[model samples]
Target: MASTSTSATSKDSPEPSPDVRVWLGNRQAVEEVTDHERLAAMTDTELAQQGEPKVRRAIPMKKACTFLNIPGGTPLLEGVGTVVKAWPHMSDASAPAWVASTSGAYASLLAEHFGGVEVREPEDPDVMHGPYTTDTAAVAGETKGKG
Candidate 1:
């Protein structure tokens, strides 16, 4: 009778090492990775020599909005000025606000509209007061807010 053994290592062959797959455009290759340090030390050329084309993943707007902590479809206030200075509890403890508008009339209008007082100077000099909304009627082929 004859005896036989099943083994990965044979007298004529050696064992294979672990490898990592990387991507370079349309080509694919395999690379033997000794360890994480060696893999991290590999150059772009070396990585590309043994990599496959990578697939990109896209995130939906709803998922992205959830991740960003902002509600979807919220219009950004473009022309709103940043708070250069804040006067909190100057007159009343309950009312706290910032001096953001430069124009006195505009500031008065804003105060009347939003129930806030207008200050002589903005806490921030860089902030400006203006009408910032786009004319949707004009965009839709109607003459609105376009004089």
Candidate 2:
């Protein structure tokens, strides 16, 4: 004969972990992103009243690299990645926009780091969902290629 017992353990229940908590907290600290102009058009003061920034600051490539863990051999080279500048009042309104750029072999690598959104062409101000802002990142400073 075999004996069996079943019981519910407190640990088995789904609970929010600290990482989830921290991510949510960070997300909240920034403005709510959207493609709706009517919503984004709210003034900076208005956004502040709502407890958010009209335009969220960009996330740096270095930080993004650490988050994604791509090797240097990748097209991104080293400092090749995007900085996302949140639009004020949803600049496009009907579309999301970000301006990202890089100088190195890895335009694709930069694109990959940013969830594979197509790299936008220069001379286009309306970047719908791409990296934004500029920083002087160079190849030499990047860590040697590694997975």
Candidate 3:
């Protein structure tokens, strides 16, 4: 299954561009997907192009860095073994916790999904200290704290 994300704005495309749908693991997007039927017809190569993933706020991770698996859902990752700090989510944890932060794939996924994982800049220690949620604005014209 392809993971569709609309947060990615085309770098070269101009204003009011349509949202790009990306495949999270591949760290890429194929332009134009309005439904599952169309998306399902795309070839494997089309599904795996080098399109950019969206970055909100936080340090961009590198290929060599590591990440904690907080959400732990679909597309299971092969971790480095043993639970590390589940920071910004929990203190204590269980197995299969950390995974390679390859090409910022996992970091991008967490950022997009608000999956409770982050790679903050080491020099900037003040950005994240506790649980955080991205974008206070909710869907359907509803603000986070309001009805």
lDDT tens digits, residues 1-147, model 1?
111121123456554311111000101111222355555777889778965333222222211100001111111221111110111101112322332322343344334434564333443332222111111121111122211
True-vs-predicted CA distance for residue 25, candidate 3, Å: 23
- Alpha-carbon shift of residue 85 in model 3 (angstroms): 12
Reference-based lDDT, residue 113, model 1: 39
CA lDDT, every prediction?
Answer: 0.24, 0.28, 0.27
Q: lDDT by residue for model 2 over 1-147, one digit each (tens)?
A: 111111222466563221100000011112233435645677878766775423343343321111112223332232243222221211222222222332222333445544654544433343222232221222333422111
Query: What TM-score do all the candidates reach, one by one?
Result: 0.19, 0.25, 0.18
Between prediction 1 and prediction 3, which has the larger lDDT? Answer: 3
Per-prediction count of colliding residue pairs? Answer: 7, 9, 0
The per-residue C-alpha lDDT of model 3 at residue 116 equals 47
Provide C-alpha RMSD values for all models, in order. 31.8, 18.6, 18.7
Candidate 1: pairs in clash: 22-51, 22-52, 29-50, 29-51, 84-123, 84-124, 85-123
Q: Give the TM-score of candidate 3.
A: 0.18
Q: Looking at model 3, report the run of 10 residues with the lowest lDDT sum.
A: 21-30
Model 2 misplaced regions, further than 4 Å? 1-76, 81-104, 127-147
